[model samples]
Target: MTGPLITDWSAVSPYGIGRAAFEEGFRSGRTTSVPLENEDWLVGERADTEACLVPGFVIKEVLGKKGTRAMDRVTGLVVTTVGRLLDTTGGPLPSEDPDEDTALVLGTTHGSHKSMVDITRDTLTDEKPYYINTAHIPNAIGNASAGMCAIWYGLKGPNATIAAGRNSGIATLNYGRRLLATGRARTVLCGAAEEYTTDRSWLEWHTRGADETGTVLGEGCAMVQLRAPAADGRGDDDALAEVLGVSSGITGPDGVAAGLETVVGNALRRAGIGREEVWAVSASAPAGEAGRQELKALDALFGDLDPLTLGRPGQIGDTGAATSAFQVVATLTAAQDSARAAGRVAVLTSVDRDGALGCALLRMR
Candidate 1:
């Protein structure tokens, strides 16, 4: 079956993401991080202890009068962002024809940590179950975040949640594109959101390993709407960017650089574009050697092509699985904003695990 095209996408980041605040941080090159001074890292075993969070979150918009007490802040982010995305896109969500197709999928590495950690604390201190657990339970199902999205939007068919460490978001897109291709759903909502608050310091400690430097945590959520092919030239209405192609893999024995060459080479071949044609690059890399490794690979793939870093993920810290997927979304948003008078094709690349990598080609419509 023919795959659907990504029609509309919107983002809600911690640093006032996708809005004026995020643009300021982006242009000024100012870091949104703070030293991990007052954080309680007693539970953090091996993770990097420091963190960077969005200074002010306009979360009250969603929880206006209801409050965020019912679920984790991260979970709230997922629902709120998707809701905003729907508001902005004005898609065919609750159409008169109930058969009108739509899909919802969310990617997250730390979905309910705020609640999970609270439950853990309670389990450690008392013989009774924690209230946080009770609160998070309804939305705590593995599919809770996406489930909330489906229920809120009344989306039917193929609603799923994805988790692959920092690569979950991109992976969700890969899977969702296929869902569209197979005709399981026509318009699809793809997203990734993560929450790493102070309470989940243990996760940070473990993730940091023996090192205490370069650890900063961030949380944000994003959603996208994918549109199917035009039938009688009616609904190809708002195709933002065609899913030209998707290719993912890890580097070979030589090094991370070699691994990326193989990944990008294959994707370029699939998209029928040349190396020199890619105009921008959105890298999904944290700080330290890992980020450099990504840069090394970028150099290898399009050594001479102009590349851009959305800044060090470590600076803003890792927002768990939602990092890379948001990276992809930001690049597309940036390219879309820049396409008014330019001829540029963008590349979104993400590297995870020992060599697991994902790359996609997006072009202006």
Candidate 2:
């Protein structure tokens, strides 16, 4: 069950607005966090925690001011990221009338908590229950970002959104795989997005108990262009990586490590690759309790192999829904640049605190 080939990718992250920025940040190996502002803290001590945010993301500069009046942060992040992909694949915008078989499947933790909270608070605190801006109400839902991409880009094919917390990278990739495998689409723009809003930052700090020794909350969107592999079984010389297989699982209480082992083993088996063949491991286990459980799971699977391990949370911060996708990007970049990592098989695994685990096997092409 080989998955669709990941032909290209683009991102808008804390580092900057494209793959170059992300790669530069990763190469520098510098911590990209800033002290949480007074209002940015809702649960943790300001001195002990920090946040990774895209420093000056202006929608008008990225997409112009036409439809931004009612756009939410999630929508802006997605549209801009997708726009960059389009810039590389074709032009900055889709053709006046492009293929209708193209699809979009985006993953997220939750779509724009700021929009949801803002709309909800407006309805409660306003003079009237309906006094909130009705025009932007649609932005409050989780699927709004995906739907907005279709509307803005004129992608008139299957459009969907999946929520699987940090495991969303493989979740969205698997869903997009179905769309391509079932012949429902010729191309898929698949990715995950998370915005570093005040509410989102506060929630991560409060819920995850993130501190100096834990995952720092970050924000960004990472998307890849996927399509059926060539019949000749050949990829472009510049292809980032070839997807072998992707699998996901959900665990009960105290089953996180076991669940991760199951999914990773399944993905490797389906790909017909042995554990010894894996040359690198991209793990999305942020620091703290969850990170410890993830490490335990990896040890169970690859303790003997001892592949090169890569984790970018400390550099990119925990990107929430975008963490695993950025991990994929990080993995590919490492495979591309590092002599030790180049032209090797890599396994990317992700685990979320809410019981979801996912793994994707990739081979540098």
Candidate 3:
């Protein structure tokens, strides 16, 4: 270990949007998700829309027309969520220090869905492609969101994005922690962000993982400000969560059990802990059989401890790449506030298509 890793970190989730909301959702023991109204239609599958969606929060109305046009909805969420995290971290508190060595690593499966859809529609509808939003199209690149975040904060440091399906978020966190331990950066603002609305149906069809299993169209952001212990004025004892170790493995579809086991085993070994050490497990609960199988695997891992789901989050739908990231963030927030939370570690796990499994073990405060 080059130095003491992240000693303190907070979370931001859609359950309530802030710390207070996170508390209410966790305290009530119910994570509630709302349904979508004006959904986008899936192009080749069943024609009509059938999943829950997030409310349409007019982007221009909030970010203003000028600042708004530079990004699509997916990108907007990353910028806005990361911005809020930075604000809570330093700007909101006079005691907080602005860390100049912060790095931004984003995890995304698809970026700029809204703009991509717009461009496709423009191309088919008009004889001339002049009507397409060329500016927005250019910004649709996967690295666009991560780059915008770095530029916004004037952070002249390592900025990268990882996309490995449902495990992208966890992989991104692993990347950040490795960088921190190697002395590549002082701190890292990291997590996953993906926009999956019914309105953006084509995106859903191409990347959708078993829709009948209730993959609610989810689109939003989850970001964490991770800093090295002893950075500026932050104390090592003040660590909110510790990054012990991380691992990822590829599995064939038939190797679901083996895939998950391979990653989880590697992560635990890296952390130097056993399955019993994990207090809570944040799962990627989709729906029906897939969701059931996921839970059974967890039951085998920690037989006694109950692995709970964020009630509303599941109902609203699986957040694709952001699935495990949101679960880890939301669970950490809850564990931090509850007095009964005694375990020093939490296990983050996820399984994506094509036999890919990712896992990370985080040591807690």
Best candidate according to lDDT: 2
**TM-scores, each model vs. reference:** 0.81, 0.90, 0.82
The stretch of ten residues in a row with the least summed lDDT in candidate 2 is 39-48
Q: How should the candidates be ordered by TM-score, best one leading? A: 2, 3, 1
- Give the alpha carbon lDDT tens digit for every residue of 139-181 in model 2: 8889999888887777877999989899888788888888999
- Model 2 CA deviation exceeding 4 Å by range: 36-49, 88-95, 209-214, 340-343
How would you encode candidate 3's per-residue C-alpha lDDT over 316-362 as one tens digit per residue? 35677777677667667766665645546777777675456777777
At residue 270, candidate 3 shows an lDDT of 65
Give the Cα error of residue 47 in candidate 3, in Å.
6.4
Q: Best TM-score goes to which candidate? A: 2
* Per-candidate total of colliding backbone pairs: 12, 0, 13
Taken over the whole model, the C-alpha lDDT of each candidate is 0.64, 0.80, 0.63
Off by over 4 Å in 3: 1-13, 29-35, 38-56, 88-100, 129-131, 205-211, 231-234, 304-316
Error of 3 at 220 (Å): 1.6
TM-score of 1: 0.81
